[model samples]
Target chain A: MAAGKPVVMVTLVSSDGQSFQLLEEAALLSAMVRDTIQIGQGRGPAGIPIRNITGQTLSMVVVYCNKHYTAAAAADGDDAADEEKKVANKKQLREWDEQFINLEQDKLYDILVAANNLGIDGLVDLCCWRFADMMKGKSASEIRVKLGIRDDFTSEQRAQIEKDSPWVWSRTT
Target chain B: MLQPARENEGVWRLSVWCFGVDAGVQFSRCENPIFPLIPSMAQDGGESRDWAEMPSDALSGVFGKLNASDILTGAGLVCRVWRQLATNDPTLWRRVDMSCQADLVENMKAKYAMARIAVNRAAGTMEAFSAEYFVTDDLLLYISTRASSLKSLHLIYCPYISIKGIAEAMKGFTQLEELTLYLSSFHGYVSEAIGRAGQQLICFRLNNAFGYYNCPVDDTEAFWIANNMPELRELQLIGNRLSNDGLIAILDHCLRLESLDVSRCYNVQMDDVLKSKCARIRDLMLPRDQDVFIDSDPSDEGYSYDTDAMYDSEY
Candidate 1:
């Protein structure tokens, strides 16, 4: 978005008939929105319909896109910013991303799929990292419990997996 | 102590089963058959894919962030869907890091077997492999036969990885970019072999025993690298015996050198001329730069906690 250019606000309707208006530049972060905008579907009274994503999920996505777009625009605008300040800004954004992504297992899964469906690669990665972080240093049973995953393996199969890599479950820490 | 290869048949069975179903789908697109053993998969049937019922893309996205140990233990063992994904996914095994849990594996033969499993899982697309104490010459030879696409090889405290074994393996790793060896007995011939073969090598870290008093220093390793790998970008020769002459030789030859960390190389005096020669390096770390490479519990033995922690350290 160039300076002095009129801000193009596009209304995005969710799966459950909920509407949210966002800046065209910010909404472009989602590939689905970008495609819709490219096809000139976002100019109507009904607005662009984001399929599958709910009002709650789309709102979260909008928050992320809005935050990242502002940060990115600020970063681009400050061409002469010192390296230290740039690093600080990056750290702040990272902190914000972490905070925003810190959700429960169910909500996290919702965002993960939403991000994936929207073709938001960065959000997908963040959600994946958050899940990975949650799963780290935990046993299979512990992880299954935490993530509400059903253990479909039989006793024999479980034993075989354990026998193959005994050390994976035997760490002192 | 060698377990028969048949021991891994169970894991292989599941992978083969997955392929069987997939191949079946390819053979007859109209038929949506569900195999009895892998019950109710319900994939590709307009079903909403969730965490338990994840698509390969999202599953791989999660698996990509996990380390080898996490995948081997928790993430890969969650359910049948995850188990199948873990076994069949080649990208997951690209950078097989057995170094982190090297000490946990009781015997060298068992570790070798596990390494074989990892390499086999990679299915010839393994790019980077890092292993510690348990790696033997035979294991290296095995990896050489399998992982022809190997680009980065890090062998830490693998005293059993003899010069002959590594040299033989180097023939397979023609595309190697980063080669790191920590507390090894690799002589100059290995470096010469790497220089000869790994022309595309960029980052070479040959860290000897850091924080050790009166450690032997020599220029042979430096000369081998300088003469062979001119395209080297980052070099960390911590606690090496590389003298000022060796440093000069490296500086003179490896013109594309960007970051050089010789933090514990006591022989290389930071003289005015030497500093001027190394002026081109952007991230130059001298011997007296807080000794960032120093480990308090540096030992001659295989299991050092600090050295294990050093696996993630910047070199």
Candidate 2:
């Protein structure tokens, strides 16, 4: 609708009662918000209220959508038909993605939760990869320390678990 | 407009490449209405998100990316929740590799019991299962029943596993492709079953050539393989005692065989006639023709004598 018409801005109300404005197309990048927009048929004057997201997280999600849409449009162009150029474009997008996700631990998780709430498949996967990478070579205790979680199991229960599956006990690597 | 858009562009652009294509999709969202979404100031004594608080499915996704041992031993015993999830999650147990510890004879019962838990979690989705020790008839019976979709099976040092048990198990694994039975004593019952059912087998490694008692694999085993596994594309038989006759039979019978490793099998000579006869095989590794000799260090013997005479020279 924005091809010749003036750019329409959709107001997004985050959980903390703050409002952020975004281009309609950029807001539609999130599957949940896109559905809300489609349901409103561009007529919801009150704006869509994201009940679980904060102002900062919503802003980040908007920025992600706008950037990804641009990359996706570029990658879908005619030159992308060539396998090598398409791969290069994907690699470029991935490198940009790497930089985007390089936030602090809690911030990354926050973005992950926000992405999931917004129904952003791409962002969810990125956060999951970072999450997995953090746990890859780390011991359970190390993962606990890094992620700021406490060891909830008692020594008795831990010993029992070790008894049940002693394989984990013997593995040093 | 362009400069601002470029900067904003960096804020977005997350893709599946960050994680693997399959994993890190989503955890069932647990929205704690009281847990404020805003990051609290450091002075407010604020609580941040806990790592262990991710959804069970999302946590399973992380465990799914880890190796089996890492999942079972490293992640499984972390805490009650992780232990339960690791024990119960099917995705983490699909490809069980017990080729290392946990397969020792002493821990055979416990580990095999643990293996049952894994295969049970895996349901029918199990693809590859391998163990370096004691794959008894009982384990095969349990696995064959559970992991019906199994494709690759490697059981090394399972001298206790009867050929009949494995052969019976092989009947269910019609999708079987890669099979490795290493460091085991001789048996021929598997040949009949493999020939009948394992038509899809692409790689076969029978390192029965290794011996606890140095009893090498003879022409009997070779002839059984020649008669049975004609569909094999790759084969390895280290420490085999197969003679020229068995090799000749194999080359003639297994016409589709592309890669063969008969290393340490001194009896089968790769003469010109034999080489030309088996010219179609691309990645063939035959036993070396001559024993590779290293030059003896004659000077080293004189050095010891020179050291002994040092006391005389000092006097």
Give TM-score values for chain A, per-prediction. 0.87, 0.82
Name the lDDT value of residue A89 in candidate 1.
Answer: 97
- Write model 2 residue lDDT over B200-231, tens digit each, in one string: 77888877543211223358767877887778
Model 1 chain B scores worst on lDDT over the 10 consecutive residues at: B22-31
Model 1: how far residue B293 lies from native, Å: 11
Per-residue lDDT of candidate 1, residues B10-31 (tens digit): 5434544765532212211122
**For chain B alone, what TM-score does every candidate structure achieve against the true structure?**
0.70, 0.69
Residue-level lDDT of model 2, residues A1-173, one tens digit each, is: 22466777887877765677777776777888888877765436677888867666666777787788777756656464599888888898899889988765556777887777787888888887876666665566655545545568877876776667665555422
State the RMSD for candidate 2.
11.3
Give the native contact fraction of candidate 2: 0.28
lDDT by candidate, in order shown: 0.75, 0.67
Query: Model 1, residue A33: displacement in angstroms?
Result: 1.2
The weakest ten consecutive residues by lDDT in model 2 chain A span A164-173
